[model samples]
Target: MRRIVNITILLYVLFGVSMYIYFFTGSDIGIPVEYKGTSADPTTFMNARELVLSEEYSSVKNFLFFLGTPFEWIVLFLFMVLGVSSKFEQWAKAITSKRFVQFFIYFFYFSISMFLLIFPFRFVSYQLSKAYHISVQSFSSWMKDMTIDFWVNFIMMFVAMHVLLLLMKKSKRRWWIYAWCMTVPLTLFLTFVQPVLLDPLYHEFRPLQNKQLEERILEMAEKADIPANHVYEVNMSEKTTALNAYVTGIGSNSRIVLWDTTLEKLGENEVLFIMAHEMAHYVKKHIYWGIGLGLGVSLVGFFVVYKLVSFIQRRFGKMMRVEGKGSFAVIPLLLLLFSLFSFVISPFTNYVSRYEERQADTYAIEMTKDNESAVKAFQTLAKTGLNEVDPPMLVKIFRHTHPAIVERILFLESYDGKIDR
Candidate 1:
């Protein structure tokens, strides 16, 4: 029995290390390319914008899109099989009898599962882009991106998981109340403070100084019913050519950030259209809705984790290993199991996001009355970003946030007679 458990642990570690090696080694190989554009080109600019707004790229990105699905199934299968297996159940009963063993086992599985599942996607992205001559062929650049993302995401995941676990242990029956209390304040802080405060740790942001463009943008904001005082341009070109703009912060900190590349590449009308879409997000209170949705999801996630953990503890308390005094090595395993459980729930979350995105699009079209500009902007974005012209329907349903560019254009075409609102 001990031998079997030890072998399972070894297999888990081996699989994790193999995946990590595949990612790092693949990313070390670079693709060489000479970019034709010295500054952000209009075509490139438009392509970038379109890529963000399109569901077309999901074909290639499907590896990641469907990655979690299999993992979730595997987890469910493992848990159920183990639960029913007389040998494993006897071992778990023995192990879970010790609190330290139970905790360590859950923690170990959680950490390893998360690391294995998520780490390879970064490598996949790096290799795919290099293959297509989209990304620079530099190990340092790849490492930089990987490291920055790892640290930021690691902190967020760690806090969320630990807090959830603590809450579950504390309240038992009323855990939801405690979880909600902890979640709401943290969500608000992350939304309002992190963008301005913590985000700069990973990327530099500087004020954009195109006086002419800034003035025009401010005027446009005023016309759109968004306060001119809330608009700012930031120099995001210092990073990569991946053009992006976002409306972040709440209340006084709330502002519109136009990436330098976006400002340089887009025409006045296109920029206005983009800004109008962002404004629509604010006007429709999408941020608050997002916060509420996150809380709801977390609540569901807590119940799932709690029930699963309790079941495991009740069934297999004795057979798990004790690594140290009062330490059970199963904590990671539990975390992994919980993550897998959460992955199963991801499709529902994605559905909610897609709905919100559609709502924002409707608001943008209605408010801007410039459906033509929106369509052109999306096309240019798709081209510049080298996004796939069309993605498979399954990919779009599972992974995409925005509607397909072609779909958006067609929708706009149907409204040709309308004036710019």
Candidate 2:
């Protein structure tokens, strides 16, 4: 068992190192020849310094993206293999006789431990954003946000795990199915409350201050047949220079949000194009489709986890000090397995996300009939975010949710509107 753990760690480390060298050590990739002299060229929009920064930033971000899952898997696996999880379980049991109370205690310590273990990576990521001039937040403000995030995640996980434990006690083999069933309501609740309750915790949100712009957005919404009465603007200027807009939530909780930076940086037509893109997500029902797909994937994932847990128990139960399927000590192992599964399935999920994004883009242009603004919007988005127009194929497969910036721009440049209207 010790040998196997050592091998797993070594393999993951090797994989990360090899991929980094292969992906990042090459000369900065240039725009393809087909786009070299065209408006779609990244060089046309971004200056030389900006281009260099984008490449450097993209390399680091993509490396970290590939490194993240393996590092998490390693930490979770170590907690189980090195007896840390059992120690946490024992400490929790020592303080209380009530099962739920014990679990809360155990999970609190475990979650903190995992957070600290992973904190360095998070710190590096934050520092990277600052170094690239993408984040304007101070350390104190960032830490405050982090603390809120920690507590929010803690409460949510505590409730979920408590339910899992109850289900486990009822039927060890079928607990995953029961837990899966519970996710539908949980997803709905979070979606319904997140924009109102959770989002306001980090940043202030208000009605779009520009009445004319708001009216125009509402008119676009009306044309899309969306029921939204107001456009929301988030105060992101204090936090970052990045520009963004998105449609979030379900039912009446649903709304379109734009970062104030997006409003300040882009022309009115560009902003409307972006807004139309977001509304297209709602109009096309991508939100519902995403939720359904996630639930479907989770259903399969839970079943696989069930089978894997049984196998782990039969093979290395004593070595890991986790004797039963239902024991709290098994939490780390379960997490490790889930991390591995998520890593394996990410490419597929990303593909679906990219497809949805493409559909939204097409709808945005058709609804607005403003191809020039659409092109400008994509270019500005890439510039502000320090995004490479053409990332490496591997990075696109795993990291990109939308079509490549170059692709989006070129598509907008070539699109012709229907003349009959």
Q: Who wins the TM-score comparison?
A: 2
lDDT for residue 63 in candidate 1, whole number 0-100: 44
Model 2 stretches astray by more than 4 angstroms: 26-28, 417-421
User: Clash pairs of candidate 2?
Assistant: none
| TM-score of predicted structure 2 | 0.96
**Candidate 2 per-residue lDDT over residues 152-253, each given as its tens digit:** 999998888778768877997788999999999999899888899999999999999999999999999998899988999999998899999898889989
Q: How many backbone clashes does candidate 2 have?
A: 0
- Candidate 2 lDDT trough over 10 residues, lowest sum: 412-421
CA shift of 325, model 1, Å = 13
RMSD of 2: 2.1
Error of 2 at 327 (Å): 1.2
For all predicted structures, in order, the TM-scores are 0.70, 0.96
Off by over 4 Å in 1: 1-58, 68-118, 156-177, 234-239, 316-330, 416-421
Best by lDDT: 2
lDDT of 2: 0.87
